[model samples]
Target: MTGWIESDRWAERARELRDEGWMLMDLCGLDRSGLGRSVVNAGGAGTAGAGFRNAEGTGGLYGPRFEVVVQLLHALKKERMTLHVNAAGDPPTVPSVVEVWPTANFLEREAFDMFGIQFEGHPHLTRILMPDDWEGHPLRKDYGVGKVPVEFISQPLMQIDSPGQSPETVAAERSVDELGQSGPPLRTVEEG
Candidate 1:
């Protein structure tokens, strides 16, 4: 995609930019099949906040337009760059911008959390705020309301050995036969 866009005849010369480098950085959404249409950021990347979005689905500039991305790439030799995704959808996958800028760690993780975009080369990928058991990326454009189901099961209240006594330990003083027969269920004043 990067190479093709840079070679576009019409788009190459239109935007006045010396191609620094092309980045597969920014991600917009996640497609089950793979990455959907990418969010293309054009020239003036670091200097200014501008992107290339051909809205109306007609291959045209929508908002603040700058240099044709292709033109920018023509001037570069072989240096890393940044691709800034504009609108991320469900499960966005932005390539690691860390190679160019290691500072992208937090931002990329944030993008992963909110947009479900994964950075392929990210060293660590874990939920920052959400619990370990959380399901579904919460910040997607089409967030689903379904949640992970919870299951309840029975287990021993306490182990045989322990230093300090916990509620479970104190409760375990009584035998199972005595629980429903004559003794209190648990946590009764008598047990405490």
Candidate 2:
């Protein structure tokens, strides 16, 4: 096992890329000063294992500007890094780097789905995961995933699941009995 020091830990890995002109754009994260331990030293830029995977496990801090985002996407695509934009957490929006990095295309959308962060300047931005009618950004910091209220007093769980209908429909079909309770309850699961 090779334990490493902070200052030098990822310096070498980022050296070549940085040398090629990538600014150590905000060594940002919750771990580093203002960024908190949120970002992983900025080296996680455009790969499968990058950015702050919110400690709360609900959201994360993806630091990137429109220009940088586009650039990063382009580089990642050339290198074939699977890209996905994930900003469902609070302040749900990651900069549109697609202008600079063409690869950020679908990745940004995925980020939108997983994190709820909107990508401005994208040719077209729409729901890639949830349906367009999805009430809330499921991955957003403010997303509420609780099951809608129903009548344990009425149909009961066992009765709700009949025929080809999913349990959810049983509740929706009788939303009148479950008024004021359309979307599921929001859980304070993640905080940055």
Candidate 3:
């Protein structure tokens, strides 16, 4: 089962589902800014819009720029449910389910780190994958693509003087026979 819940009622609905024995399976964010080229229908069929509609039946041509998807599972009943909550505003904001599900802490942080979707009431909403100094969310459609030079740790170069130690110096002072052929020797069919 799948349903779209309003952003304001996100936490409340999540709590209700939790109380009903639904286990929070996964939580992630989506950036709908690029949906103009490809359409995504969240509310299944019968909707008149290109995107999905919330529980209150509110949705536009493309809905909100950001949305949070929550997956829940009822283990004993063998049932699964997907919930979509639209995040609105300059920095898309959605109610955090971390309080209801402790596992949501890292998932919500990742959404914030990659898509810049702010999870309101998140106890510690910090960057999980990117460095603290990262300027913008890399997964957002509007974020600029820029190259970042990777600085590797400096290490002392080892001096390899023995033959075969390096590819450039392989068998430098030895004949092919001295090197010795690797693997089993080739035999004719008659020998076998």
Please name the candidate that would achieve the greatest TM-score relative to the true structure: 3
Tens-digit lDDT track for model 2 on 121-178? Answer: 6776676777777665554334456654454443323234367877766665543334
Model 1 alpha-carbon drift over 4 Å, by segment: 1-83, 86-91, 144-192
Give candidate 1's whole-model lDDT: 0.42
Q: Give the distance in Å from residue 153's predicted Cα in candidate 2 to where it truly belongs.
A: 9.5
> Each model's TM-score, in the order given?
0.35, 0.36, 0.65
| Model 2 error, position 87 (Å) | 7.9
Query: What's the CA error at residue 23 for candidate 3, in Å?
Result: 0.9
Q: Give the winner by TM-score: 2 or 3.
A: 3
lDDT score for candidate 2 against the true structure: 0.41
> Which lDDT tens digits does candidate 3 get at residues 4-90?
677988888888889999998888888877664343544432334445333244344235778888888889998877777889887
Q: How close to the true structure is residue 5 of candidate 3, measured as C-alpha lDDT?
A: 70
For residues 32-140, what per-residue lDDT tens digits would candidate 1 score against the true structure?
2222333443444345534544445425422221111211233345443442232222233334545554555665566566556656667876766677676676755
Comparing candidate 1 with candidate 2, which one achieves the higher TM-score? 2
Which regions of candidate 3 are displaced past 4 Å?
Answer: 37-39, 42-62, 144-192
